[model samples]
Target: MTDHLGSCLCGTVKFEVHGQFDSFYLCHCEWCQKDTGSAYAANLFSQSAKLAWIAGVDAVTSFTLPGTRHSKSFCKLCGSALPSIQVAGLLVVPAGCLDIEITMLPTAHIFTSSKAAWGQGLRDVPEFGGLPH
Candidate 1:
């Protein structure tokens, strides 16, 4: 079983996830884009992984969209994305929250039909290690 540690942007909330991830998906659904405020959401899925809050558990808050299965957990202070459990024992972990290197790459890009128009051709953009001069 692989173990991973993660935290919010401000480090106010810390957690550990234990077990191997079976799938990783980059979701481009509208809800996912809005939840992440990005082009897509990188999420790791595990059916039997265990999540344990190591610190600032009270600083975390969760929200579920009424009348829908969409939900998100975040640090109340920094508004950073955290992990959440979905139905059928699925553990969803946002890849960005992980502090350690992840050996696995996204298995697929789902919800392509709902992808933002601007989300395409991102590879054409310039790449830089840091702030460009």
Candidate 2:
């Protein structure tokens, strides 16, 4: 595993994570789409214990989307999305901020049923009908 660091667009928020990442992958869930204002979100998961916030917790914001217990963290200064840890304590970091290169391909794709039709053509990756739990 490798140790890495990253920050938001304005550098107001920064974090560090320890893990050997092969590469980050795209998440096509509708929540990802709406949260990122993009077609998909690039993210990678690591243990919560491996992540550390270096600065700007004061600018962090949290939101829960309607009925789902799943909540999200973001940068209030720039609206840049941040990673959230689940009850299992898995830290999911946005892949774009990684300072080190990932070596492993994404293990699988979750929420494939909600993927945009225009986002198709990823025929080789394993896909799940719903969230990959």
Candidate 3:
């Protein structure tokens, strides 16, 4: 198990997580794209219970996706997106937010049916129709 540290772009927010991640995932859902303003979002899957806010949790703002059960956090000052915890308490930490290099290859590409045609093709990773069980 490795301890990972991450912070928002503005350095106003930071967090740490420890233990083996369940997996890494590429989320291609519309909500992910809309929230991240990217073709997809790469995240590390881990238990939210192990996460610790090292600094500025108060500086993070959250917004729930309309008509959905998911939400995202971001730096209030710089609008830099933060990782999110889904309904089941699975923390999804953005790959870009990490201060260290993560060698964990993504385990799944989720929401394939909703993915953009020109977006990075799943190619080799396991593809899930939606959130995997």
TM-score top scorer: 1
The 10 consecutive residues of candidate 2 with the worst lDDT sum are 18-27
Q: What are the per-residue Cα lDDT tens digits for candidate 3 across 108-130?
A: 99888888877755586788999
Query: Which 10 consecutive residues of model 1 have the lowest summed lDDT?
Result: 83-92
lDDT for residue 99 in candidate 1, whole number 0-100: 93
Best by lDDT: 1
lDDT of each: 0.94, 0.75, 0.83
Better of 1 and 3 by TM-score: 1
Model 2 residue pairs with clashes: 21-102, 21-103, 22-102, 22-103, 22-104, 23-102
Candidate 1: where are CA atoms >4 Å away?
Answer: none
lDDT string, candidate 2, 75-128, tens digits: 898988776675577777787765557566777777777888867776767889
TM-scores for the candidates: 0.96, 0.76, 0.81
Error of 2 at 97 (Å): 2.2
Candidate 2 is scored at a TM of 0.76
Cα lDDT tens digits for candidate 1, 1-133? 7789999999999999999999999999999999989989999999999999999999999999999999999999999999999888789999999999999988999999998999898999999999999
What ordering of candidates by lDDT runs from best to worst?
1, 3, 2
Worst 10 residues of 3 by lDDT: 116-125
